[model samples]
Structures are given as structure tokens and as C-alpha cells.
Target: MTIHFSCTQCGKCCHNLRLPLSLDEAADWIRRGGDIELFCEAIPWPVEPPQSDAQAAHKRRLSFAAMCGAVPIRVIVTVVAAFDGACPHLLHDGRCGAYGQRPRVCRIYPAEVNPFIHLTPASKACPPDAWTTDKPVFFANGQTLDSETSELISQSRAVAAQDAQLKERLCAYLDVHHMALANEGFAIHKRAPDVMLAALERLKHDRKQVAHGAAATWRFVSNRLSTVDTLVSIGADTAEVSSLPNALVSYIAFFPSDV
Candidate 1:
């Protein structure tokens, strides 16, 4: 069934709402000279420590939690401006200040035309006669909608794929490191141990799997090694540890000596 919708310019959708944005939407908002900062905040995800006692629990937490949780497929990381009470951009005259060039999200208010999902908020904020909800509807203000829609779908898919790949790599790294530490104890105040060598080898292999080029590999390997270097500099390995490596050594240093 063909359906249409018209926005009543009520500020209900703009106030106390967390609107997710796509890459295109974010770009459009930036072009409109919108205060992007007001739209988004970095929300930290909850994390549980890795199962392995030897694993760097905090280090693996971010990547591990991300992998286990669902990544929003089309929701690109962008500033989502919402007013503390009502949107600051909303004017006392019952209109948006940047109506002509508002964010793509704003332009499509109350009508989610994207095929993957639909969003509908109640009509309480609008005047009693200004809007209707008798039926589910989606409205886009454009001609040649098919072509534009196709292009947008394609671009959103590409972006989703890239984010998936990055999340996969990070998860794999955490998974491998966690496995290496299982059932193994590492000394914090000792030189590299044999087990440490094994852990390093596993970590290096994981890096090589993700990093293709020599330069890329070098950068990745060096960054991983730098953590060890920092630990060693801080006297994490004052004595020789035959089975524990620098990572394990560093992990131990953070615990109380009684432990």
C-alpha cells in the first residue's frame, strides 16, 4: 500500500530523543553548520574480565565486549544532537532554526523510509490536528526516489562491512591472547620466561594474520612490543622468569605483593 506523511513541525521528535545517524546523515548535518557536539556522546560499554587469570583483563575487555555485543548495522558513529530538555536548535516560534538545511534525520522526522528498519514515535508533541497515525507510513521528499535509495543502500552496506572487519580483527586478537594465558602463571618481576616466549609467538602470529604488508606488520608488532618495553622499564621483570614473558610480568605487577 502506498502511504505518505507530512511533518507538523512539532518539537516532540527533537526533544529528549537519541537519534541514531548514518554516515551520510552526519555529513549532511556538518554541512548545515549544525552543532555536532550537542548530538553525540561517547558511551562506554559494559565489560567483564576475561576468563583466563593470566590474560590482561582490562586490556581485552573493550574488544571482547564489542565482539560479543551486536554492532548496529547501518547506524554509523555520528554526533546525535538531543536537547537536555528540548533541542536548543528548536525556536520559541515553533520552528527549527535550521529547517531548510537540517540534518537528514530531521528532514525525515516521523517517517523512517529505510527498508531495513522503521521508527515511529507517538504524535503527542504535535498539535491535535497537525499529524495522524491511523496507519504506518513512510514519506521521503524527493523524486527519482528509487535511484537515490539504491545508492544509499549500497553505501551503507559498504560502511557496515568495513566496521565488521575491524571488529573481527580486534576480537581475534583478544581471543588468541586469552587462550595463550590459560593455565599458565606469569611472573611480574622477572625476565622473560619460556611461557612468555610462547605467548609472544602467539600474539605475533595473530598480528601477522591481520597485518599483510611488511610496513604494516612492523608497526603492529612494534606497538605490541612497546607495551612490554614500558613494563620492563617500570621494573616489572626484576628477576629472570623462565616461563613468563613481559606481558605476564606486567600483568602481575598491578596486583598486591601478598597475592
Candidate 2:
């Protein structure tokens, strides 16, 4: 069945949501002078039941925490930032501050795209009156997306999948284990942008180095490094560890583990 939607510019969708971002997008946001931590969050990979013995073995081999059911079956990190009650980019007049530069997910809004669903109206989040079955159907842009919606949805799905794959590759390269999401209501520090930026750069450099086998000996050495040392090398301030909130500390502590 065909769906119809038109954004009222009420700004409801911009509030109280987790905005997931790709690595490049996060970097771009930082470059744009945006407060990365205030609007972004890092989510660890989710735990899922093993689909096969092989998959279960892979998970177990990745970390002892997984074997003990403390870690997720997959080992990738996702970046998401909280919007609290309203997006910081939402202007006072109900307009987006970064309208032109908004993420692809925002551009495709009211239309859902994920691993299980694609090109469907997000009925629950959308206002009732925003959708209609009569007359011509319109999208957020006030244009008919009937023919283009499918392609847009496909592209969005592809991008999301690509981001996940990249994260997985990075995790494999770095031999990461036991990554975990922070508690939903955890407080983020003002210095989150600095910490995340440093982490991102370290991941990028380490991934490249590992790819070329820069130091076969170093890989073995890195495996022996403690979580604190790993965090410090990745630009996390060990000195500030004592001052960080409990949630952040717990999340960081899950980074290093052995199967």
C-alpha cells in the first residue's frame, strides 16, 4: 500500500531521540564546530542469540566476556548522541539550524529504514494528521516521493549497513572485546568531543597499521595491554578517570577483554 506524509515543522521528530551517526559524519560534525558529545553517543554492539555453532564459536573466541554472557555476540561500536527533550540544532522558531547539512536519516524522515524494515512510515513517531490516504501524497519536502522513495530508502539502508561493516572491521583489526552501551540516562561530560575525537583518530591509525602488519611484535604486545593503557593510548585521559561519571567508567572498562 502507498503511504502519505507531510512534515508540519512542529519539530517533534527532533526531540528526545538518539541520533546515530557514521564515523565520517561525526568527524564532519566536529569539523563544523558542533559539540560532538552533546549531540552524539557511542553505542556498543548488541547481544544476540547465536544463529549457528560457528557463529557462537566466533563470539566465544572474541572475548571471554562473551563466553560468560557479559559481552555481545558482535563486537562493533555505534555512535549515537542524545537529543534530550529537543535537538540542540532545532532553532527557536522550529527550524533546523543545520537544515542543509542534516544527516541522510533526517532527510529521509517519516520513512523508516533499518535492517528489518525499509521505506515505511514511522507511524508511531509521526503525528496522526501528518499522514493521509486521500488525494495526493506529499513528503517532508512538500514534493511527491512516490517514485523516488524506494531508491531513497535503499540508499539509506545501504549507508547504514556500510557504517556497521566499517565498525566491525575496525573492531576486528583492533581485537576489541566486550564493548558495551552506556546506561540510557548516563550523564555525558563536557569534554566528550575531545575524548571521542581522540578515540576515532586512534582507531583509524591503528586499523591502518594493523592492515599493513606495521609491527607483528606490536600486535602481540597490544594484546597484552590493559584496558587503561589501551584507553590512554587512544587519547582517553587516565588522569581524569577518577573524575568521570560511573557510567562512562563502566563503559570504558568493558573495552579490553580476552576470550
Candidate 3:
């Protein structure tokens, strides 16, 4: 299905929005003379570690499976800080300061909802205020995923850069958790911190034995990354479509058989 909508530049989409950046994206912002601190406002949330050996094995496999697909996934969650009082780069007059080079997350606003059986009212309304939709979009009623909308919302190179950043962050997050597993009274296993750390380090080292170079890098390197599942889970959805305003505006499915 196709969706159609145009932006009137009402600036509503700019409010209460948290545009996250991958490490590369943030770095690029700095390189381009944008404030690095401004891009650092988005907070990273913790991902719980596997509880047991069996679970760890299972999760490891899952992580690999999840990463197999090529579709880029990244989360630019809306945190209070990022949305504190309108983005610093957002002009007082409603224009984005970094329009020509705005972050990927911000560029994808309004068209950012996920694929779900059910959608909240808040989720439905967010897009229409600054844009429109035309597909069987769950969040926005009567909206269809029309070609025009799709064209406007198509992914860009900057978004790909953000995806790479997400990978770096995830690696770092796992490393920190691996360390925490060594605590003496750590609730997970009551294991001694030093002992567990030693064992984990060994395991980490062994996993690097040429055979699993990619997996090894994933474990040893600290990185940032994003995925559609994680992004949709964290972002807020408008409950219903807001009235048309003077503004500009902006999924996926199971695998299909080859023809």
C-alpha cells in the first residue's frame, strides 16, 4: 500500500522529540561544526544480561539471528533532556538549524512508527500534525502507506551512519555487563567478581580465535547501534492524528519466498 502527505512546517514534530545519534553521527556533527554536546542528550538504556548458561547461549544465537537482516534499525528515543524545551538546534522561528544536514533520526520523524497489531492514540496522532499517511498504518487511522509518503520517508545515508553507531554502543553495553557478572554478591549467580571476570575474559579471548572474527569484534568492541524493534519499543506514539497544520512532514514484514 502507499501513503501520501505533505509537511507544512508547523514545527509540532520538533517538540518533545528525542533524536538520537550513533557515535559516528555525533562525531560527524562535531566535524561539521555542530555542537557535540547537543547530540549527546539521548540516554542509553540498559539491556538485561542472560541469567544462566543456557539462556546466554540462546541469547547469543538470537543476537546473531537478529543481526542477519540488512534493513537498518536504530533508536533515537525521546528522553526529557533531548526534548527538554525544544531542540537547541531548532530555531525559535520553527525551522531546524541543521536542515540540510539534520540528523537521520529527526529526518525520519512522523513516519517513524513501527509495525504492530495495536497502536496507542498518542502514537496515531503524532504524524498527522506535521504530515500525513495513506496506508493501513495502525497508529494513524485511515492512513495508507502510499508512494508519496514512502518517497518522503525513504532512508538516507545518514541513517546508515547511525546504524553503525548503534553496533558500537551495543558492544560496549555487553562488555560492561560482562564485567558486572564478576561481583561477589552479584544476584545473578552469587559468583566472585574476580573469578567471574577472569572466566569471562578467557571466554572472550577464546571466542576471538580467527574462526569467529565478526562475533569476536562484536563482543570485544564497544559500539552503538539501533534496531526497529528497540526503537519502536522506546518511542512515544500519538494517540490520534492531530489537525492539519502548516508544516512539512514525513516497515516491515515476515520473509517472503523467492520467485
Candidate 4:
């Protein structure tokens, strides 16, 4: 089925959202007095994903290579401005206060960052009227009708890859190193505006050191002990979140899958 979408200016999309941001946008987020959270997840990468496959290519493009104990892995990082209620810039009239200066993600609204993911209107925050026939066809024949959105998505993927290593090191610098398994969930690391800004700033200038000095170690955190045990059996270092009373890390389990 074809998908038609147009912003009815219902402003639902702007409310109670966690917008992903680039590293630069993350810095700007703090300047706006808003908080940013880092979400990190990793997938085992014993062998390089095939460049010919769309999902593999896309995943490799957005992740950085690193070792998990003795296991090699590719880690993906997401920096988000996690705000509740209405967006800080959402005007009373439903206009974006800083529309012109909105983040690239805002410009790519209602679309997914993952190529394999399909857009489901019912799953979106947009209202039913926003998907009426009168709206422009957003997706058809497995393609997005909007070329600019496609371009922005590509750019976002490239930039995420560019910042992948730095973002990982940023976590290391802040002592936020536990990661959830990819496709399962994310290890949420919320940082205060000042702390995150300081870490980013300090890490920015120490890029060379962070990238080349020493390989900072990382551990896996899981809600399922069986999952962690599975990783441990495979020689991957693991951290039990239950044992850490004061660790900044928290796990968001997507499914309680049996290991």
C-alpha cells in the first residue's frame, strides 16, 4: 500500500519526543539549556558486513569498530535531546519557533534512520488526517517520494559514521561504557547539560588521544542474566546492572527474549 503524508500542523510529532542529534547539535542542545542522552548499542563484528547488502552497508556506515573483551564489535551511538511534553520550540500556534534552524532530523520527520524499517502511519505520532489522500505521496513502490529527505538521511548516516568513534570515546571519558546488544535495546546514559558539554568539549580537543592513545575497554549490560551469561560464555566482558548501585547506566530491554 502507498503512504501519503502531510503535516496537518497537528503538532503531535513535536510533542514528547527524543530527537536524535549530531555531535554539534548535541553541543547546541546544551546551550539551549536542554539535556542530551547518549544511547549506545553494539553488534558482534567478527567479520566485516557485506558491502553489497543494504542493511549491512547501512549499519557499517553508521557504526565504529571496537573490541568487546576479545570479541570484535561494531558500536552505534545516538545522541538525543530527550524532552518531555511539547518541544521547547513548539509555538502556541503550532509553528516551530526555530524552524529555519531546526536540526536535520526535524527536517527528516516521519521517516526512519534505518533503511530496512518501513513507515507505518499508525505507528507514527501524526494524526489520521495527516495521512489522508489529499496529502502528497510520502512513500510508494518501496521508495520515498521526497528526494531531499533521502539526501538528508544519507547525510545523517555519513555524519553518524564520522562521529562514531568520537561518540564512543565521549562515553569512555564520562565513564559511560556499558552497551546493550544491537537490535535488542540501548544503554541509556543521561548526562547533565554541563557534564555532557564539558565531556564533549574536552573530548573534542583530545580527539587524537581518544582515537589513538589507548583502546578504552567496554562492557555489555543486560536485563537478562541468561543474556549476559551467553555473552560471557563467548568471552565478551559483561556487567550486571543490578550490581551497580550508582552507575549512570540503565538498560532499555526491547524484548525478554530467551537466550
Per-model lDDT: 0.35, 0.48, 0.34, 0.81
* Tens digits of lDDT, candidate 3, 1-259: 3334455677766765445554445445545443322111111223435567663433232222112122121222111123455766779888988798776656555555222222333553245533345424422353425444444334433344334333333333223111010111011111233333343344445443433322211100011122223433444111111211212100011222121
Off by over 4 Å in 4: 203-210, 245-247, 256-259
Higher-scoring candidate on lDDT, 2 or 3: 2
Candidate 1 local accuracy as lDDT? 0.35
The numbered model that scores best in lDDT is 4
Q: For model 3, give the 10-residue run with minimal summed lDDT.
A: 179-188
- Per-residue lDDT tens digits for candidate 1, residues 108-214, read 44444344344333543545444355533343443213344445545544543443323334323322211111112221121222332333344435544654321
Return the number of clashes found in candidate 3.
44
Q: What is candidate 2's lDDT per residue for 1-259, written digit by digit as tens?
A: 5566666677788888667666666666665565543221222234544667664543333222212132123322445555578777889998999898877667767666553343445544667666776524644343336566557667765655555544544333333322322322222323456666665666556544423421111111111235335444654322222333344322233234331
How far off is residue 136 in model 3, in Å?
A: 15
Candidate 4 per-residue lDDT over residues 1-259, each given as its tens digit: 6999888878888988879999888887787777888888999888876677888777777777788999988878889888789999899999998788788888888887677888888888888888999889998887678899989988887778888768767877787767898877888887668999998888778877636533558788777778789889988988766644354667778987443
What 10-residue stretch in candidate 2 is worst by lDDT?
Answer: 214-223
Instruction: Give RMSD to native, each candidate.
Output: 16.9, 10.2, 17.6, 2.4
Give candidate 2 regions above 4 Å deviation.
Answer: 33-72, 118-123, 138-149, 168-177, 180-191, 201-246, 249-259
The Cα RMSD in angstroms, rounded to one decimal, for candidate 4 relative to the true structure is 2.4
Give the lowest summed-lDDT range of ten residues in model 1.
214-223
Per-model TM-score on C-alpha atoms: 0.35, 0.55, 0.38, 0.89
